[model samples]
Target chain A: MTTYTFEPRLGTDRTALYVEVQQFYARQVRLLDDLRAEEFAATFTADGVFAPSPGLPPAHGREAIAAALRAAHARRFGTEPVRSRHWYNMLRVDPGPDGTLVTHYYTLVMVSRPWDPAPVIAPSSVVEDVLVYEDGELRTRERRITPDHQSF
Target chain B: MTTYTFEPRLGTDRTALYVEVQQFYARQVRLLDDLRAEEFAATFTADGVFAPSPGLPPAHGREAIAAALRAAHARRFGTEPVRSRHWYNMLRVDPGPDGTLVTHYYTLVMVSRPWDPAPVIAPSSVVEDVLVYEDGELRTRERRITPDHQSF
Candidate 1:
């Protein structure tokens, strides 16, 4: 294996930048867990694309993605949303070649269904995100959620 | 949604250390791809534990893990090893509470079957690793591989 290097934000104290990126992700996941559709849409760029898996077509644009998320959440939890937590770990931030930030992490979603008293942990996945820093904020350009195993 | 923080390494130029940990992981994956069973076993600590998933029992100790890996590889590829590549991306290194190094990354395995001319990408997963620094080298103390989805 060749030496693999991710020299994003090299020669600088990018600790603060990394922290900000981490916070951005944290906020995004929070919005998702809370079912804040509009606010979650604000986290992405105007033309951001969110791909759930390789087999399915991606939702194009932030608006479309938000609608999809809202529909999915509503279908699963109904009007009274159940308590859920999105745990994101192993956050890594790197600079893309085209003046964007690339971040990746693992996400574990835990929720207490209405019928069950105990929390149920859903299947987890690794998210690869391409983010653009605009107006001093990070926005998603493209996000790909890849599951760990083959579904079909 | 509370403000989450990842203060694993604060106010330190941890680039060198991250690079070292990445190298250790790189070496481990390389040995596995090359089918060097004995050498791959040496990358782990004497009492290291390798858990492929939560549903399955873990392979305790480095020797056992290595033997299992070797047996699996032999079964899949037979006596003659075929070409395969394991791509590890988005590597994140953090400091563990007990002075060990914690690492997480996404791995995508691509292999060429004996009858197939092209390589097929296998299911990918996130690997969470606990590593110890011994004799100026990093060794895997525990590794848990969590798949992104359920296979039924």
Candidate 2:
């Protein structure tokens, strides 16, 4: 198997830019990991939207997305010991008319519980998240997580 | 509902570049539609690789991918109709070490038979294809379809 070198910013010395985006993703993941719902919801813009795509539940606005995340987090943490990793594989950052358009790809992830040598659910694929940055902060201009692979 | 656009070549001419890319994509799709395995496979570089994430089959190398397409065509032909519209979306072509790192998202497909819609499967997001230009013609270096939306 091939491994990816986590460059994060992909060699862009736009240190703040990299960290800004990183922190946003980090915060989102951490909120889920820590089970911090309010904090998680606060990260989104007032009008932030989450559209899983046609035929799927599309939670629009920060409050709606936050609520969905809360329920999902509950289910995820309820059963699983909550060990997981969200890795950014391929990232493309561009200047948009409104803010910085950041397209990030999540390559691989492992979610396992204690006493389990293998992961309960390990995803081997990439997910692209399109984000927008404003006022030196990050918000979901759009987050499109494309599935490179999927397992039950 | 909202919409998205794709761009692979930058600054040179999105119009002409899109037309060029469209031609290649069209040819491949049409060739595949025709069930001509060899010609369909000819769209890629000999070393072209297919990376299908889980819940999907993986086809690597020109010959193997071609064979997979042939089999897939056999199954899909009677069920679906090839799209005439160019559904390429979020196409961003970047310079790679060997060639252009082409990333694009596509899911809007043409329906051949309304009675049976083709199963929404792998590459659940965007069709991320790596392209190389030879003799002013473009061929896939590697094509990885990542889908943002998924079905079972």
Highest TM-score, which number?
Answer: 1
Backbone clash total, candidate 1: 1
Cα RMSD, each candidate: 11.3, 13.5
Which portions of model 2 show Cα errors greater than 4 Å? A1-23, A52-54, A76-80, A122-128, A148-152, B1-152
Q: Give the number of the best model, judged by lDDT.
A: 1
lDDT of 1 by residue, A71-132 (tens): 77777778764665566778898877666778898876656544443345567888899888
**Model 1 chain B lDDT-worst window of ten:** B1-10
Estimate, for each residue in A1-152, the C-alpha lDDT of model 2 and write its tens digit: 11122234434434345445656776687775565656766666566656543335767676777777767656657664567665443243444443345454433445667887866433333344545544445666455443322211
Predicted complex 1: CAPRI docking category:
incorrect
On residues B49-90, what C-alpha lDDT tens digit does candidate 2 reach at each position? 776444576776678987887666556564444422113445
